[model samples]
Target: MSKEQQIHGLRPIIEAIENGEEISKIYFLKEGNGVLFNELKHKAKQANIATSYVPEEKLYKLTKENHQGAVAKLSPVKFADLEIILETTDMTANPIFLLLDGITDVGNYGAIIRTAECTGVTAIVVSEKGSAPINATTVKTSAGAVFNIPICKVNHLKDAIYLMQAYDIALVGANEKASESVFESELNKPIGIIMGSEDRGINPSTLKILDQQIKLPLKGTIGSLNVSVACGAILFEAIRQRMF
Candidate 1:
C-alpha cells in the first residue's frame, strides 16, 4: 500500500467513504464511541467497506499524526465502471470476462489477473466488498499485469452478472463439485467465468445465476487446486479454443 492510499482521521475517512473512494478497510479504536464514530461506522458499512476495531496502540503504530480514532486503507488501482466497459466492448469479438466472487488473497488475485491478461480476458469484475485490495503487493505479484487489464469493481457481483447476461454473455462458474470439466465445456463465446475464494468457493446465491458450472479434473490425490491455478487453467482453455 502506498502512503497516498492511507486515509486517517474520522472526518476524512467518512468523507472518503461517502465520496465512493475505494477504501479497502478501516481500523477504528475499539473503545472509541460517540456520534462521530457511529457516523463513520455507518458510512463504511453502507459502502461495504471492511471495518476493524483495534487498540489505541494499533492506531498510534499506523501513524504518528492524530488519526482521531480511525484509519482507512484505500485501493491502489482505480476501478472501471462496468456500464462504460460493457457499452464500449465489441460484442462480436466474443470478449471474455473474469468475475471474482469473494476472492480475498492479494497474491492469488494478482496471479489470476496476470493469467487473465495473457489469455486475452476482456476485464475482471470484482465485488466492492470481500475482494482483495489492489495494493502494491498485488501489482508486484502480477508482474505489472494489473496495469494491463481493466478491473471493474462493483457494489455487488450479482448485478454485474445480470448486466453481463443482458449483453448475451454466458456465465460459467468454477465449482469443485460441478459435473463437467473445463475441457468438456465450450468456450468459444462471449463469457464470464466466476472464481471463488479459497475458503468458501463461490457464494451459493451467485452460483444459481451462472449459465453453467465446470471444474478442473483432479486425477491426483489433491482435493482442490489453488484459486489462481484453477483460474489460469480455465482461461487458457478458452484461449486455446478461440485461437485454434
Candidate 2:
C-alpha cells in the first residue's frame, strides 16, 4: 500500500468521508472504542464505506504514525456513476457490461478489468462493499488498463442489475452448473455478464434474476477455472460472436 493512498487517525477518516472522498475501505482496532470512534463508524456507515475491525497490530502495520485506531485506504481512481454511464453510452452498439459480485482478490479484479478492456467491454460494475480495493496492486496488475475503462461502484449489485435490465440490456451469468456453454449462447447483443467471487459462484438470489446462465465446458477433473480466466474466456467468446 502506498503511504500517499492512506489516511490515518479516526478524525481524518471522518473528515474524508464528510468531504466526499473516494475511500476504498477503512480499518479500526477491534479493542478500541470511544466517542470519536463511534462517530467515525456512524459516518462511514452513512457514507456506505466498507469498514473492518482488526487487531491493533494491523493498524500499526498500515502506518508508522499514531493511527489512533483507524486507517483508510483511498481509491486511486474515481468511480463512474452507473446510471449516467447507462444513459450516456451508446447502448445500440450491442455493448457488453461486466458486473462483479463479491470479488475481493485484488489480482483477480485487476485481471478482470484488463480482460474487459481488451475484449471491448463497455464498462465494469462492482458493489461498493465486499469488493476489492482499487489500490496500487490492482492498478499495477491491470497493466494500467484500469484508466481506460469506466468502473462503477454501486450500493447493491441487484439494483444495478435491475437498472441495466430497464435499459434493455440482457443479463447473463457465468456458473459452473449452468447447462448452456458460452460458445452456444447468444452474445452479440447488449448484455451484462455477471461474474461471482472466487469461492461462491453467483449469489442464488442474483442468479434467479438473470436472463440466462452460461458455462465453459470442462473436460478435466478441475471443476472450475479461476474467475479471471473464466471472465476472459466468456468475454472473448462474446467478441468472437460479434465479429463472426
Candidate 3:
C-alpha cells in the first residue's frame, strides 16, 4: 500500500477519490441509517466500487481515532506516465489539454473535472500542491465524471507546461492582460489552456513562457468568472470549433 493510504474522517475518504486515488473498497457502519448514508450507498453502486457494511467494532479495531462511524480501505488508482500522457493522446493532430494553475477550491475543481470529461479533453494536468486532493466530496460534485477522465499530477506546474509545448501543444494563458479575446484565438490545433486561481491568477514564473494569452469578454461589473466556469467555456469552445 502507498504511504498516502490512511484513515481519516469520512469526508477525507471522499477527497482521496476526488484526487484520483484508487479505492479497493469502502466500509460503512452496518447499523447506521440516514439520508446521507443512503446516498453514499447509491453512489458506490453507480461508480462500481466495492462497499461493505460492517459493525462499529470493526471500524474501531482498525483505527482508534474518530472514524465517523465508517472506514474505507482505499487502493490507489493507476496514473498515466507524463511522457505517455503526452504522446498517447491526440498530439499528432489537433489535441486539447487543460492546465489548472493553482486551482485549490474543491467545488471549482470538481466542476472543472466534470467539464473535462464532458468535452472530450485529452487530459487534466494539475500540480501536486495548491490543488484539491481527489476526495469524496469531489466525486459527489463531479457526479462521477472524475472516474472517466485522466488526471495527471506533477511536481511543478512549469515543468508540465514545458513538456506539453514540446509535444507541440499551443499553450495559452487566460490572463486579463492578454491582447486577444477567446473568440479571436486559434484553438483548432493542439492546445493547452492555463487557468489562474480564484484569489490569485497564474503564478508569475509560469507566465513568462506563455505561448499566447487570451481573455474572456467581460461585459459586467464583476469582470470575472469562477475558475471552473472559465475552464468549461474555453474547453467547450475548442470542442465546438473542431466540430464545425
lDDT of 2 at 197: 96
TM-score against native, each model: 0.93, 0.97, 0.71
lDDT of 2 by residue, 35-77 (tens): 9999998998988889999998898889999999999999989
Candidate number of the best TM-score: 2
Winner of 2 and 3 under TM-score: 2
Sum up the clashes in candidate 1.
0
Error of 3 at 233 (Å): 1.0
- lDDT of model 1 at residue 33? 88
The residue-by-residue lDDT of candidate 3 on 82-164, one tens digit each, is 77878677666687888899887778888988998898877888775577656656776788888888888776889998888
Question: Runs in model 2 with CA error above 4 Å?
Answer: none
lDDT of 1 at 183: 92
Pairs of colliding residues, candidate 2: none
Question: In model 3, where do residues sit more than 4 Å from their true spots?
Answer: 1-5, 8-63, 66-77
Q: Write the per-residue lDDT of candidate 1 for residues 215-243, one digit (tens) a residue.
A: 99999998999999999999999989998
